[model samples]
Target chain A: MQVTLMQGILIGIFAIIAGIDFWWEGFYIFRPMIVCTITGLILGNLTLGIVAAGLTELAFAGLTPVGGTQPPNPIMAGIMTVVLAYTTGKSPATAIGLALPFSILMQYIILFYYSAFSVLTKKLDTYAAKGETKKFTQLALLPTWIVGLSYGIIAFLCVYGAQAPMKDLVNSMPVWLSHGFEIAGSILPAVGFGLLLKSMLKAKYVPYLLIGFTAACFIKFGNLMPVAIIGVALALIEYNRSKKDVENEKKMKAVMENVNNDGDDEDGI
Target chain B: MESKNTETTPKRGKLTKHDVKMLGVRSLFNQSAMNYERMQADGWTLAMMPALKKIYKNDEKGLADSLKANLQFINTNNYTAPLLMGLEASLEENGEKRSTIDGLRIALFGPLAGIGDAITWFTILPIVAGITASFAKQGSVLGPLIFFLVYVAMFFARIPIAQLGYTTGTKAISKIRENSAIVSHAASVLGCTVIGGLIATYVQITVKTKIPVSAGHTIALQTQFFDRIFPNILPLGYTFLLYWLLKKKNVSPVILILATFIFAILFSWLGVL
Candidate 1:
């Protein structure tokens, strides 16, 4: 289960590309599923990679960076999840639990970058004042390179340098602790769903939520497609109703304006 | 006003179609230099560079002033940002006052962020991710590919959206604001529904605690009690507890994640989970 130097370097290179994409949000290849899949591909474990991608994706589903706030970094979590599972010969669930520290570590690093990059604004101001478009453009793009390179170095170190320690740590874990990690992994997706609901849930929409929950949990289906179709249907109905409401409101306003115009004409006469 | 500007300032530079296309391309880097001080300000100015350069080709002072003005604080959804960029560029092309362009930019970003977040982040991606995660859970390769393609499509969508902004100019503002409310409401309806289904399907919580029903016989709590009453009740309740903590108590997600780990491990140690 030892990671080769070549594998580590490839993973590091992938990390750089994903890291820049994550920062720029140019293409969203940094999601846990994609990151894990690529890592698995590099490590020559495609099935393991796909399995971990599914589990890890759900766990990190609702942990999106909204505004300034960031959840634990998905790229590191994704890379380490597959790596831990691959190196330690454990289930994806257990690897998810073990990979959390790395994710949080990256989160802090990114936050640090956010604060550190604040210093560049003064540099930007100066460039603008001097009308140095070339320097300004270069400086503007500098942070992305820094972000990508940092990801590369960290991924390389974690994958290659820390393998022995990670393996040893996994071996030393008692049955209870390892089982506990498994349990934690299974329960973590609830937090993601909760975060999503916090943003999207509304008092009026609670019924649709209940319907979806009921259908998915109680009714037997081969997959969740039926439930999703129901959701789409509801969405269509809601969309049409709201559109009509807007139209009706506009009509009412038009009528009000017409009456006002009549009143103005009478007053002028 | 148009006639007066054309006669008096015939030397004013105009942005070509190529310039607008480049602006859309540059908008991809809108968050490249994101920071805490002014957020996406530097990136915003960079994205507007091509148009700014062309419109102010002979006026260095005007170019610098526009750059300084654009470098002020700006935070908005990256996808919808090109719309504002196009609008600002058009205004600058028309020789609009600096205050007018700056004021409109500030005024529009908040609403654009709200609409973009609602449509793209909350609704479309989450729903797609949920469905695709199910496929990936079963080890289907289509999962990642589909999600990647969908996102790529969204990335390219910036071109047409930017074009829409440029052609419609300021007149599009009222229409966008009018439709945004309805669109966001419908989007959230779908988002909530999908999230509810996702919670039921994705969030797994099992209770291993057993109770002796009769002599030498134990009933499994998870199956015998919780399942008989309502399947996935524990997951639903747990999701609600976390939601309540997040919304009412204002607990950070990082804290919630850590606490979930601790409690899960503690419960596992107690043989309750």
Candidate 2:
């Protein structure tokens, strides 16, 4: 489990990416597939990665970023869950079950940093006003990248530092407690999925949702096939609806023009 | 907002638009950037209103006033400070009236959300955590570095995006009257493609479950079809139940925590993986 130079660099890069997402977009960038794939690629455990990612994804599928509100920090959860799974050689489900509480803790840090960064915004704005592109870029990119990279580096150090002790502590967790986590993990994602599904509700979109649900419950196309299908359906529906509306408008405009001509004839008479 | 004794009917306890923008200054010291993180719509307006008014209406102060009107937008209101500013400069360059700010915001929101989701969520966040996770998986000692990387990225990246948004918003609006189709289409394509890629690459889940069949009873009872095929009757049922609870409840999501913990305990005790 010794951190290699290459591995360390990779971790730093991912950390930066995560930080950038928070700074720029403001949503949970982590996902189960992503966590699994990265962990798998890094640890030479593709199956483990997929499993871990799947577990994490399911456990937290419903989490979404709304306006000013924060959900649990999925990036933290997904990353940590994968790492825990890989290091411990535990199943994805088990890893996810164990990681939820830990992940929840990181959300506060994210909130704190976001609130704290207002100070930096004013400084950057003043710099930008003076046409200091270099300073502006420096201000904009450096802090976030630092945040992202530092998270990875620090986590790496801590994990490296605590490996043996944590392993013993986890191994010693009671059977019932461990099993409880598994069950809780299993049920958690439903809430997330529920939230997502609830948020996307609209009359026109309901048909696609039903289709997705049916496919999920019965057909089994796998992964997000149902969701993708919904996306496509919505797109098509919007397109078709707009197209028809345009055609109808043209017809109405022609009718209006005819009526206007009749009025001109009456005025001339 | 201060209360009144019917001299103003207390004015619904709402602050005037000026109060909102002034509050933005307080929020500046108190908070930064629009909080688009809630998956809500407030951030877009908050982050862009001030800048948008300046760009389209030739009124920088007006932009500030508009924001005060829309202060309820929370996290998004702060970032609008930068966006509207850049947009004002961009519009002034084109010699256009600044009245078109509202159109610009409506125009930009969808494309921004689409692009924003991918740019922030897909590309940047993953890159950071991917690096960190790689090490964490191997029991590397740099787990905390991964966390810090995210913090850094969050802090640094906002300025330019907000700035760029302003510049683009003002410019993009004018295009609506001149080759609007091409502009919106391009934005749509970029937005959709990024979203598609992210959803495909992320969101990983695998499911296995079965229905129970009622065939036989006590002595030499035989279980038929569903149970014979698989033994996951409970997991699927539990998933559905959880979904049901979520759909039915108006209760605070905190209740979900209680339910999750309770189920986890129950399942663990019952030996349900």
Candidate 3:
């Protein structure tokens, strides 16, 4: 189960790519679903990679970067989830719980980068003023390189350098504590859903939420497709109704304008 | 004086299709140098650089001034930033008043961010991720493939959207605002429903505690009591509690995550989970 040095290096390089994509929001391969699967591929455990992808993806679902504030680093969470599970021979669910500290650590590092990158703004301004387009472009890309390199180093160290200690630490944990991580893993998705609902939930949408929840919990489907279809239907209906409402409002405004014009004409007469 | 020059100059520099396309490509790095002081200001300038250079090829002072104006604390969704870039390119090409261009940029970025966040981040990505994660849970490679393809599609969509913004000029603003309101609303409805199903399917909590019902038999707490009342009441109730704490108490997500770990471990040790 030990990760080979070559595999570790490959993962580090992948982390670099994912890290830049995460910061750039370019390809979005930084998402857990993609990150974990690729990590799993390199580690020769594709099944575990896909399974962990599902767990880690849901666990980090609602943790999006809004404005300047970020949630815990998804790239780290995704990488470490597979790494811990692969190295320690634990369930991916248990590995998710164990990966929390690494995710949070990366989050702080990113926050620091946000502040540290401010120093470059003055130089950027200078370049822009002088119309040094080439220099300006190079300077603008500097932060992304730093971000990618840091991810490469950290992933290499964590996956390759710390494998033995990580395995020993997991082996030494008491039965209950290890079991606790499994339970915690199962429960952690709630925080992600809660964070999502905080932003997206409204009183009007409660009924739909309840419907979806009840359907999933009660009706044993092979998959979630039925619930997704229902959601799509509901969204379509909502879209049509809102379109009509917009049309009606426009009509009402037109009538009001006509009424005002009539009154002005009568006053003129 | 500037207005007089612009009115008299009928042969102002124009943007080519190639230039517009490049702007869209550059927008992928719109947050590359994101910093605390000016946020995406530097990236914004970078994305618009080629277009600005072309538009002000004959005037060095005008190019310098435009670059300075563009680098003034801009932050918006990366996908939709192309629209703004195109719009600014058109304005600069027409030699629109600097004040007019600045005012429009400031006015639109906030609303664009709102619409972009609602559609891309909250609605589309979450719904797709939810469905794909379900497939992925069963070890299906289709899950990651689908999600990645959808994201790439969105990325490429920036090109046509930018072109639309450029051709439509200022006329598209009100229409975009109107359509986004409806689109975001519908998307939210879909997003909420998907999230609800996700909560039930993803969040797992089962009561392991049991009570003695007879000398030789014991009633299972989870299957007999909790499941009888509601199949997933614990997960749903726990999700609600976390939501209340998050929305009402305004606790940080990091704190909430840590608290969940503590509660899970402590409760497991006590044999209650």
Candidate 4:
């Protein structure tokens, strides 16, 4: 359970990479499953690592950044969840509950990072106004390394510094609070589904939504792929039907215009 | 309007392949120094610097003006940003009407954002992550591996899309706009169904309650009634309730999260949910 200096550094590097991957390229290397697996690989506890990853992933699943606002920092949560599980020998679910506070803390850290870099953006504006291409480029990319390195340092600290204290703090917690966390862990996924529904739901897609819900709830399919396939079929059918309707409408409009033009020609004649 | 300067002006072939490729790659950091006031303005202008420099090679003032114009408050989908960048760059290189470039950028950004968010955030990531999580739940290494490889492909795929826009110039905009709506809508439908399936599969809340019918006999409500009627009714209902609360109340997500925790604990204590 003791993380060496080299492992800490490696985790730090991964943190930087994940940071860039997040808001930069839109890749999800920072997702809990990947982060935890990497942590497990480094820590030589794949079983516990995967377990912690799964728990944290689900708990954080509902929380995604919409626009500039972040939902709780899942990347930070994932790292701490694995670290806590590896160090304290806690169950995956327990570690997730324990890591929730860290996740929220990291959210503020990110906001601060955003605020701190505002000055850099101002500097970029000046450089850009002056057409100092080199300076502008340097300042433009500054936030990447700054944000990435900050996250890296935090990960290193979590692995190297917070181990014993985290274990103590988690171990000292009263039973009811921890049980509450266990329950909270189970209940939290609804938030993600809710957020997703809030964002993705449209009146036009109501039938599809009902179909999806019914297919899953009534038929009780064990896997998601089949339901997804059905969804694809339904969506394609609707999409094609709509496209044809649009085309037909266009054609009708064209014909009406032609008929009006003919009537005008007769009047002219 | 500026036709007299065309004979003396440099032609449209100023930007080399390298510049476009670099712009495509650099567009990844469009949010690097992003702020609330002018989101992606700094990073975007920075990414376009090289391209603008190429287009306005001898004209420092033109480059500065272009850079300044791009620093205006603009936000759009990250994936298709490169395409806009490419379109703008090509338009600049071709000495197209300035107003035309500005108009196209403003017009395309909002719609691109809608399409990009639907495809990337709502549909692809959720479905892929859900499937991978299911695999990871069983402690398979393939879970993480699949997520990484697939996502990495999607990430790198942005480069070509940008290159396509640059090579094709403004002609591609209408095509992109036309197709994106359909793509976005189709993906959303698929996304909803998959998310629905995910809700059923992942949001597990089992009722472990029993009711006594007589002194010697007790009936398990979950097993005797709920499961028989609908297997994952609790989870579905809970998800629906959360969705309704979010939609109707416009509750702060943080407050809703706290409420969820409190309710979970209280319900568990009461042995009801």
| Maximum-DockQ candidate | 3
What would the TM-score be for candidate 1 when compared with the true structure? 0.95
Arrange candidates by lDDT, descending.
Answer: 3, 1, 4, 2
Where model 4 places Cα greater than 4 Å from the true spot, the runs are: A1-6, A174-176, A217-223, A262-269, B1-13
Colliding residue pairs in candidate 1: none
Output the worst ten-in-a-row residue range by lDDT, candidate 4 chain B.
B4-13
Docking class of 2: incorrect
**DockQ for all models:** 0.75, 0.11, 0.78, 0.61
- Give a tens-digit lDDT track for model 1, residues B1-273: 778545544355888787787888789888889899998998899889878888888677778888999999999998889999988888888888779989999999999998888888888777888888888888888888888899899888898788878888989889889888888888888888888888889888899999998999999999999999999999999999999999999999989999998998899889998
Query: Per-residue lDDT for A29-145 in model 4, tens only?
Result: 788878888888888888777766766776677687756677888778888788887887767776776777777877888887767777776676688778898888777777787
* TM (chain A) per model: 0.93, 0.76, 0.94, 0.87
lDDT of 4 by residue, B30-141 (tens): 7877777777788788778777887887776677778888888778878878888888888888887667888888888888888888887788777777777767778887
The parts of candidate 1 lying over 4 Å away from their true place are A256-269, B1-10
Kindly give the stretch of ten consecutive residues in candidate 1 chain A with the minimal lDDT sum. Answer: A218-227
Q: How accurate locally is residue A84 in candidate 3, as Cα lDDT from 0 to 100?
A: 97
A175-221: candidate 2 lDDT, tens digit per residue = 78766665566566556544544443334444443443343344333
Ranking by DockQ: 3, 1, 4, 2
User: What would you estimate as the lDDT of candidate 1?
Assistant: 0.89
lDDT of 3 by residue, A36-71 (tens): 999999999999999999899889888998776778
